[model samples]
Target chain A: MEGFETIIFEKKGQLALITLNRPRVLNIYNVRMRDELYEVLSAIESDSDVHVAIIRGAGEKAFCAGADLSEFLSAPAPTFARHVRWHRDVWGLFLNLPQPVIGALHGYVFGSGIEMAMCCDIRIASEDAVFGLPEVALGFIPAAGATQTVPRAVGPGHALDLLLTGRRVGAQEALAMRLVNRVVPRNDLQVEAEKLAEKIAGYDQGAVRKLKQAVSRGLDLPVGSHP
Target chain B: MNSIVKLECDRGLAVIRLEQDPPGPGLADRLAAICDELNYNTDIRAAVITGSGPVFCGDAATAHGAQAAFSLSTPVASLNCPVIAAINGDAIGIGLELALACDIRIAAGMAHFSLPEIEGGLIPFDGATQRLPRLVGRARAIELMLTGEVITADEALRIGLVSRVVPAEDVLNVALEMGREMAGKASWALRYCKEAVYKGLDRTLAQGLQLEGDLYFLLHTTEDRVEGVKSFKEKRKPEFKGK
Candidate 1:
């Protein structure tokens, strides 16, 4: 297995796990983490030994609280664009991965954190998980894919309800709304996510890949139509 | 809009085109009638849906006569076989809702999408309010409905709104390919999977799992399942009879 510095990368059987390690700052995504994430995702994508990927945070405080707001203050426009590109690339990795990517979410899953989780194929959140996109409150919008992915996962009215209100939603509500696939006790998040990953990994890889591609691709086509 | 629905079936694949020119108004009733016809027709295993003109569909209702437009939801819910949308052009408002109602949506490269119901001093009454959130998530769906901004096909694909984005002219071809592919799959399993997914959406996990188990038991008794296993053992293609 390939090693990561800012994030922990490990593999158990067919599962590849990526843990966001910056718990002291609640795993806020900064330039270093973003770069490292891109690297780790790319590595996992290329690793034939890996059948599934599990993403989670290192500590109990947060999965991620969005981009490092403090880092934004010092970055120039071009640099910011570069950072955005990097983030998008990482998200693309999660979205396009052949194997399923499951998000193990807990604590505060906000802003970019929610964006990241949305990119994954499946999301399993802890009971204490709090999800929101407070960018609008800061006079900024969710520049990440949140503007697109969030609405698609939920629905227009509910998506609007959350974006407009910027209120935090709990895990049970998130699952009820279909925002996340499952909600478990905080301590059971990893185990539950891992179990889901294991179930997915045990399936026919080609069939699963084709199904994911077909379903993902089918969403864009017209009803009864396929490209 | 009244002329949007057309039926074509070939080699077990069914093609349903949305040929209405926007503003798409009267198309809903026609779609409902077609849905009625399809319910009785047994030939098609998988179906493809697309637009007639450059635009896949526009708002279901125009400003002049609000009550004249048809509702896409009724026909959408009535569909039995898997429906895929080949969005060849812009899909907005009810157009977007129609796409949402389908099992899958494929868009043309030039396709643009939006839900402007919020800006029109009305909510997305044609299932957009409910379906969009189910497909995307609460935050992103709200942004589109509230802002009424159009997003490109690529953006739609990235966000999970639509499944695939193809060249404008290739929309139908791609949809046909998918229809054919699906038609080749185990018909009973496909139907059960579709039913389980949609029906289980609003149910609790236990209920959903119970439903899955029941359906799985039923599927195990099907001729197709036995043939599938036999075919696997023999390394041959299974000729499914859809029983």
Candidate 2:
């Protein structure tokens, strides 16, 4: 937590909250945010006192807009960029976190925003929230885990529709598609997210973590093989 | 040669109707035979399957039950062409199994669905135990099977069990309407799409994506694919001959 700047990490009881602190830019994911998130998530992974973690954005506008084009578009070279990406493994860290991560999303959730939200074990979206993956339109694909995780949550058809068309989806439609666990009124987003985090924290952490492992691993197995 | 399972093929759409007044033990065999006919009938592009009676199967004659049901449903799962189940009434036990085997299901407004085998101390011997979870997820699947509840058409639609719902009288006609429309597409692409989805379910995301890319590439080599591209350029509907 000492090196954190782009994000805020705080522990209240057993719940650890990670808030994207870049409200000025709508929390656009940039080089700095990526580096800070990697460090923060690593600390959360090792912190046994944190039974559950919540990721949200500061202010009312966005969970995250997308990548900071100013930084990404001017990156060194393709080969060096690949190495930079390989060194972090931020998305893998998000997925491998032992504690269940809940995403409290609102406003703009696009491209890397949606990808980040997809990594969370449970997602609660505000009614005003919008989701999309605009990478395909930008002549690139979602290099993040969106390609895989989106399909796992919403099935191939819906995932393909969103990825190929790059269309925006509202909170209600996202809920219907199983993209988010549920949708709440914009005003009630924080309350709903906190209540859920507290409830999950109240449960036996051992059983909860084990159950998450069973499901995450079980889905990868062939149909009849799950024991 | 069984009268209970009637097969009628016209144009590119095939309709299979199960018409056992009180479905006999041979229903399973007849269903298997119907699966074989559809598989061999290369001209057929899409299929509509419905049961003719007050109930789809008042109760499917579960002859040897588990093993028999598993063998019977295997062909449906692997059908090269898409099959749409026009569920007209209550689908319980093995009857529900038959509908679950189809690619899409359109249930009648009055229809009810259940897997009451648990009430009899038997689990779903068919693929329901597996397919249900894939369709609706594990928690709901467990609740449905464990509690053995009968859900209405609306409830089924809400849970993704059936894709659509129509009046009881229109179940067959609606299914035929949809079948004909889908049958009119590029047959090669239709078959490949279904294949990728059904097979993809068994593979990892990376593997599934690879399989999809392979099948998509294979489609480009087909005559129908060429015609499809040509038709789009010429602003006319492509007449696909399944080549």
Candidate 3:
């Protein structure tokens, strides 16, 4: 919380809010941000008082426009890159969090931004939000769970449409595809996300966690094998 | 002409029509046997399962029949070729279960889908409890099964239950068109792709990718694949011999 340079973590009642704090660069996910997020998420996972969490950006322009290419594009030795990635499985930590994570999306959510949002259990986007997965156009594929998660969320046809074409999707269009749970005015984005988090937090924690686990685990079973 | 189902195979496309008005008590076993026949029938490339009359299929004769329906439904999923369900009208109870067993479902605009087994103090025995959630999401599946809610074709499409909803008269035609299109593709690739996708569902991403990569390499070694590339270069349609 204190040493982090790229994110601000705050606890409010039973809800924890983690804001992507690099507003000047549109909250681009730099290496520092990754390290900081891993630390914060670890803390949140261990915190017994936190029943739910909301992830959003600090500025109005974007919610983490993706990786900081300046630092990431400069080739690190393959071994060093692997070592860094091994040390910081931030996305894995995001997915494994026990409490449901709600993504409050706004402005530009592209590439890694969309990948991160896909990790959340529910997503609420502002009407001004623009979403895209431009990795294909950038001569690479989304290394994050976008390959699997996008298809799971919006079916294969639509997932392929977005993945292959790299087209930008508006908030309304995203809602129609069931990519986001709800879309709201830009002004109400934070409050709406907060309200949902609090509402979920009010539920029986035991029942809520069990239900989440059941669906998450049960979905992996083959059709006839479901008990 | 069969008492249980009518099967017609033409140009690699097989049409399986439920002959009984209500898909009667013994329909489950008969349909399962038909599936067994189609599974190894190398001549059949794709299949469409549609009823003869207005209603695709009605409620089963007894609770025992419903149980048999569940036990026998797995064969449809096991077929080597793709199976499409052309739902012409109300698909309820066992009728809906039969449709759910198919790989793809095309519903008529007037068709209604429901899993009403719960109302009779029973769960959907024929894979609906499992497959419905897998097709749609957990929330919608739970709501439908728990409430016994009957949804329209449009609603079914919105929820991802059915791939497409066409007019009542066009349901069979649409399904046949899709069947023919799938039949025209390289048969080896079609079967291999289906195998990969279906089998991959039960695997983790890493494992699934490995399987897909293996299948891709295997396809490159097939004669059909060579013909495909050759045809592309020659600017002509490739004649696939299902090798």
Candidate 4:
């Protein structure tokens, strides 16, 4: 966890706190972040001590603006890229983390950022947050399973609107659309998310997992991850 | 232009206007032809399907509810570019279905929408039954279909039925600006993105990943794939050949 460059992983009591740490560039997801996330998520999934997790960004400017398309789409070869995606499948791991994951969102949540936030069971956004899926407008499809997850979370109309037109919705609009569970002041976002995570951690862990399975699995799940 | 459907193209953007209410007897074939041209013309990257003088499209109250609906949906659903449904007026019956088929929908603030077939003792034969639920949700789709209530544009936007609500005079321009923005992207990538997302919706997780990966691999064989990467490295726009 200490060696990971893109994320900060820490365990406090029964709560696991994961922060997207690349603040200089607004925590944009990159290949390094992908590999690090894979390692951290695999660990979180297997750790029974962690009853709940909170994911937030390190800086005030953004939760995560987007992804480093230049890095990802520039894989040296298709063969190598395909095999890595198949074997690692970070998006799949993130989607199915057994523990309830709370997203403490702020600033720009676009492309993979919005997709990642959607994976969390409950999203708490700061008033300054903005959500979008501009990948198509940028001349690439979001490969992080947002095509499926977004419709499942906010329904198809909102999903396609964001996906096709690249429209950016503010946190209040996101709240109206039920994309996020709640919107708070920027300073309270992290604490609110963590408090919810603690409340869930206080509950019986097995029951929480069963509850998640009962609802989410019933609604279908990420196209990148197995049920 | 044909009797009802009119086509206009400008630098990779195509605008198809339904010039008559209930379109025309030839609308099914007309839309099919438009879709065919959209598919074959690699230069065309985006489209706007709107109606003339206050209606996006109107349905002919006939026995061909299911058949007509299918005819309207299949062509638009199978397009090679992203399409915007610029609803300037009431989009009712098959009209609503046509709007539902497009990837993105924009409506004038005063426009109305409904899938009122259920009120007429029939179900939505076109793509509404499927696409509506897919767009909104199962419960909302059912409620809208069962009530057969016409909703205003703002209400439609509230429920995710339409993404944008604008003044009537600005609807077409707003849609065209959006279309032109998307139209600037690599044409082949646009089609491929549509394919992956649309078909991926129906495929299993493993199969969806396979389709995505396979498509990524397939692109390696194309010259545009090389050009895409090169352009990025060169810090300039890619000159996609649509090859």
Which candidate wins on TM-score? 4
Query: Judged by lDDT against the true structure, how good is candidate 1?
Result: 0.73
| Model 4 stretches with alpha carbons more than 4 Å out | A69-74, A221-227, B62-70, B216-243
- Number of the predicted model whose lDDT against the real structure is largest: 4
- DockQ in order: 0.03, 0.07, 0.05, 0.39
What's the true lDDT of residue A54 in model 4?
A: 90
Over B1-243, each residue of candidate 1 has an lDDT whose tens digit, in order, gives 435567777866777777666634456677777777776766556677777877888775555335644688668766776677889899987888888887778799999999877675777778887788777766788899889889999899777788668999999888787678667656556555556556655554234434544554556455665565556446687677776
Expressed as tens digits, the lDDT of each residue in A1-227 for candidate 3 is 79889999999999999999999999988778888989999999899799999999998899878766565335464446555554676877787788899999999998789988988999999999999975433323455566566767776435544654456899988998888999999999999999999999999988888887776656566558555
Off by over 4 Å in 1: A1-227, B1-4, B23-25, B63-65
Q: Write the per-residue lDDT of candidate 2 for residues A130-222, one digit (tens) a residue.
A: 998765333244556676677678764456446544669899889987999999999999889989999999999999899888887777775
Least well predicted 10-residue stretch by lDDT in candidate 1 chain A: A135-144
Better of 1 and 3 by lDDT: 3
* TM-scores for all predictions: 0.54, 0.60, 0.58, 0.91
Query: By TM-score, highest first, what's the ranking?
Result: 4, 2, 3, 1
Q: How far is candidate 4 from the true structure (C-alpha RMSD, Å)?
A: 3.6
Sliding window of 10 residues with minimal summed lDDT for model 1 chain B: B204-213
lDDT of 2 at A150: 78
Scored against the true structure, residue A41 in model 1 reaches a CA lDDT of 82
Candidates' chain B TM-scores in the order shown: 0.93, 0.93, 0.93, 0.90
Question: Which numbered prediction scores highest in DockQ against the true structure?
Answer: 4
Cα distance off (Å), candidate 3, residue A147: 9.6
CAPRI class assigned to model 2: incorrect
Give TM-scores of chain A for all candidates.
0.92, 0.96, 0.95, 0.94
Sort candidate 3 into its docking category. Answer: incorrect
